[model samples]
Target: MTRAAIVGIGQTEFSKASGRSELQLAAEAVLAALDDAGLTAADVDGLITFTLDGSDEVGVTRCLGIPDLKYTSRIPQGGAASVASIFHAMSAVMAGVCDVVVVWRAMNERSQFRFGQPIARGNIPAGGGSSFMEWCLPFGAQSPASWEALTAQAYMHRYGATNEDFGLVSVLLRKHAATNPQAWFYGKPITLEDHQASRWIVAPSLRLLDCCQESDGGVAVVIAREDRARDLKQTPVTIHGAVTTLPFNHEIISDYYHGHDLAQLPMAQRVAARLKDLTGMSPPDTQVAMIYDNFTPQILMQLEAYGYCGHGEAKDYIRDGNLELDGSSPLSPNGGHIGEGYIHGMNLITEGVRQARGTAANQVANVKTVFLASGVAGAIIGAG
Candidate 1:
C-alpha cells in the first residue's frame, strides 16, 4: 500500500481542565491541526478517535463546522490506542478510503473524571470481579503504580537491579522537563537523591515521582497521502511503520504469572523488530525516541525491547547517562509523561513531531526520525 504521512499537529495547553466540554476540546484541537496543515474544516474527509472517547465522531464534526465527511472510525484499548488513532487514520488515507484524516483525543480525565481513583465510587457493575477492573483493584492494585510494582520487583530479582536503577530514569526525565517551558515541571529538576527520598506509591518499583500526572487536555494530528503531503506548507513526516501488539493474556497492569520474567515483554520486542524491518531503521539511525512512559519501568523495558540494550542491561545502560539529551539515546525531550502532562502518550507523540521539526525546547541536533511508543488503544506509531 502507498504510505501516509503527518503534515500538521496541534494541542491545547495541558492542565487539569479548562471547563470546556469534551466536544469543544475535540473541535479546538482538530481545527488547530487543520490550520497548521494549511487546510480548513472542509478539507477533512475523515475523523478518528478512541472508543472510550466521550465525544462521538458526528458530535465533533458538527462542533468544528465541518461540512462533510467520507470516513470515520474508532480504536480501543484505553491509552494504548492513542498512536493507533494515527495508524488507523493513515491507513485509510493510504488505501483511498479518505484524503484528509483527523486523528484526535480529548478528555477531562483529571478535572471531572479521575481514572486513577477506585471505580467503586460510581457503583460497580454486576458482571463482577473478573473485569479488567476486578483484576487489580480488588487486590490492592488500585492504581498503575501498584500494578507496575509487581513487574519492577520481579525485574530486580532476576537482574539484581536496584531502586537506584529505576531512580535514574526519574532523574533524567525531570532534568529534561526543567528545560522544557511547556512541561508542567518546568524549571523543576529532581536529583537522584530527591527521587530516592520521594514517597513510595507501590514500593520497590514505583515512587510518587515515577508515575505520570493525570492531565486534562486534547491533541490532534493531520494525516494525508505521502504524495499529497508535499503540497502542504509544513515538512511532511512519513509514517514509516505502525503496529500494535497484545501480549498473551494481557491484564491491565501486571499479569505476573504470564509475565513473571520482567525482562520478557516479547510482544513489544516482536513489534519493535518488525517496525525496524519495515522502515529499514536500526536503533542507531534514529535521532530521538518518544517512548510512552506511563511508568518509569516501562521506559526501561521499551529500550531493551527495541534492541537498544540486551535483556537486563537497561540498568547499566541508563546509569551510564546514555539517555541524556546529548548522550547516545535521548529518551524523552518533552519531559515524557513524568515531567510533561500525561495525555496517554499523545504528548510524547507531539514531542516526537517537535523533535523532527527542530523546535523542541530541548531539541536534539539533526533529528531525522522518531519512534513513538504510545500506551493508548493498543496502537503504536513510527513516523519520520
Candidate 2:
C-alpha cells in the first residue's frame, strides 16, 4: 500500500485564553504547518478536524485561500477523536481521494465554554448523548469529571491503586513540561508531595492536580504521500499504523455500560491490538509514548490497555521509573495534555512528530517509534 507521512506540524501558543477566535487559531496553525512543509495553501486538497471543532472547513479553506478541497470531513468522538482525525487523513491520501491533507483541532475551551461545567439535559451535541448520559445526568453525574469518576473509582478499587499513585503520573509529566517552553506549565514542575497536597476535585479519587487544565489553542499537521514527503523540507514521519475502535458496545468517556471490564478501557485495547497487528510492533519497540492524559487515571488505564503493562501493573510501571525520560518507555515526554496545554490531544500528535524528527524540547533518545492513543483510537508514527 502507498504510505502517508506527516511532513509538517504547527501549533499556537497554548494558554488559558487565546484572545482570538477559533477560526483564526485554526488558520494560523494551518498556514504555519504549510510554511514548515515549504508548501502553500494551493497545495492542500483535504481538510480534517474534530466534529466538535468551532471552525468549519469551508471557512478555514477561505481563510487559507486554498483553491479547492477534494475531501473534508469530521469525526465525532469528542476529544477522543484526536488520533482518529490523523487516521482519516491517512486513509484519504492512501485511497487517492486527496493528495495533501491537513488535520487540525482548534478550541477556546477555557475562554468560551468550559467542558468541566455541568451540562443541562439534552445539551450534549448530536450523536453525543446516550442512555449513559441520560441515566447519570439526572443524578449529578453531569460534568465529564463526574461521569468518569465512577469508572475511575472502579479501577482504583479493582487495582488497589490509591490517589497517590495517580498523583505520581501528574508529578512526572509536570517535570517533563517544566523544561518545555511550549507547555502551559513550562516552569512549574510539581512534586509528589505537591500532588498529594492538592485539593480534591471529585473526592477521594481525583485531586485538582489530577485533572487537565482547559486551554485555548490550535494544532495542525500536514500529511502527504510518502514519496513526495521524502522530497519535502523535513524528515517525514511515516504513518506505520492507525486504528479507531469502539469495541462491541463502548461509550465515549463513559463506557461503564459495556467495556468488557469497567476497570479496563476496551476501546483503547482494541485500537492497541489493531495498531500492533498492522505495524508488527508492540510496546517494547516503542521508545516514546504521547498517551492522552486528560485525567491521571485515564493515563494509567490506557497504559495497561496499550499492553505497556499488565492490568493493575501501571502503578508498578511508574514506580520502576519506566515513565521517566531515561526509563524504558518515557511515557508522555512532552508532558501530554496534563502539563502541556490541552488542545484535545492534538498537541500530542505534533510532539510525536518532533520526537521522530529528533527535534523535541524533551527529546527521547533514538526514538524510532512514538505511540499515541487518544483514548478511543491510536496510531504509530515512525522515522522513515
Candidate 3:
C-alpha cells in the first residue's frame, strides 16, 4: 500500500460557543483544510470521522458545497477513533480507492449538547447511556468522573498508585499546557494541593480539574499520497504506521468488572506492539507520546501498558518528569485534552501533524516519528 501524508490541517477556536451549529464548525474547518492543502472541496472524494462527531459525511459535503464523488466512513469506539480516522483514510488512499480524503469532527456540545455533565435521571438520556448510567448515576457516578473511579479504585487496590502519583500526571500536562498559548488553561499551573483540593466530581478518581473541558468546535485534515504532499504548500506529516485495536469486552468507558485492569489500557499495548512491527522502531527511540486524556489515570495506564515504564511503574516514572515537554519523552506538549480544547482527540491529531511538520509551539528537536494516540484509549502513530 502507498503511504499517506497530511497535507493540511484546520480548527476553530476552542471555546463554549454555540452560535454556529456543529455542521458550520465542521464546514469551516473543512474549507480551511482544503485551502491549506491547495485543493478544493471538489477534490475531496472520501470523508472520515468518529462515531461521536455531529456532522455526517453527506451533511458536511452538502454544507461545504463540495462535489464529492466516492468514499465515506466513521470509525467507532468514540473519541478513541480520532487519529484512527487518519489511519482509515491512509488505508483508503493507499489502496487507490480515494485521492484527497478529508477527516473531520464537529460538535456543538457546549451549547446545544454538553458532554462533561451528569445525565438527568428524571429526564431523557442518550440511547447507549442506559444500563450503566442506571446503575451508577444515582450513586453519584453521575458523570464520567464517577465511572472512572471504580476502575481507579480497582487499580489502586491491585497495585499501589497514590493520589500523589495521579496528581503528577495532571501536573505534568498542566505544566505543559502553561507554555501552550492555545490552551484554555494556559498560564495556569496546578500544584498537588491544587489538584487534590479541586471539587470532587467523582471521589478517588476524578475531580473538577481531572476531567476534560465541555468544548464545542471542529477540526479537519486533508490527506494524500506522500509523494504528492511535499509538492504542496507546507511540509507533509507522513503516516508512518497507524493501527486501531479494541480489546475484548471493551465498552464505551466502564470496564471495572469486565476482567480488565484499570491500570492497563490493553489497546495501547496492542497498538504499541503493532507500531514496533510496522515502523521497526523501539521505545527508547520514541520522541513523543500523545495518548488520550479523558481522565488523567488513563494516561498513566497507557504509559505502563505501552511499556514506557514497567507495569505499576508509570506513576513513578511520571513523577521523575519523564513525560514533560523537555523531559525523557514528552507526552502532549500541546496541552492534551485536559488543557487543550477537546474536539474529541482531533487536537492531538493536529498536534501530531504539527510535530511532524516541525511547526509545533513546543517543537521537539530531531523529531522523526510522531506517536498520535487517541481513544476514550485509541492510539495511532504518524510521521513525516
> What is the C-alpha lDDT profile of model 2 across 124-192, one tens digit per residue?
444643546767777877887877788899999999999999998999999999999999999999999
> How far does residue 105 in candidate 3 sit from its true spot (Å)?
0.9
The top-ranked prediction according to TM-score is: 2
Q: Kindly list the per-residue Cα lDDT of model 1 for residues 1-384, writing each as its tens digit.
A: 778888888888888876888778878888888888888888889998876678898898888888889998877666667777777887798889888899888888899788566554222523211245555666767666776778778777888878878888888898999999888899999998998898888777778787888888888889998888889978888777777766676653554645446556766676677667676775545778777788788877778877788988998998887888988878888898889887776778778887887878999987878777663222233334
The clash count of every prediction, one per candidate, is: 12, 0, 5
TM-score of 2: 0.97
In model 2, the number of clashes is 0
lDDT of each: 0.77, 0.88, 0.77
What lDDT is reached at residue 304 by model 3?
A: 76
**Model 3, C-alpha of 70: deviation from truth (Å):** 1.0
- The C-alpha local distance difference test score for the whole of candidate 1 amounts to 0.77
TM for every model, in the order presented, reads: 0.92, 0.97, 0.92
In candidate 3, how many clashes are counted?
A: 5
In terms of lDDT, the poorest run of 10 residues in model 3 is 122-131
User: Where does candidate 3 stray beyond 4 Å?
Assistant: 121-140, 282-284, 375-384
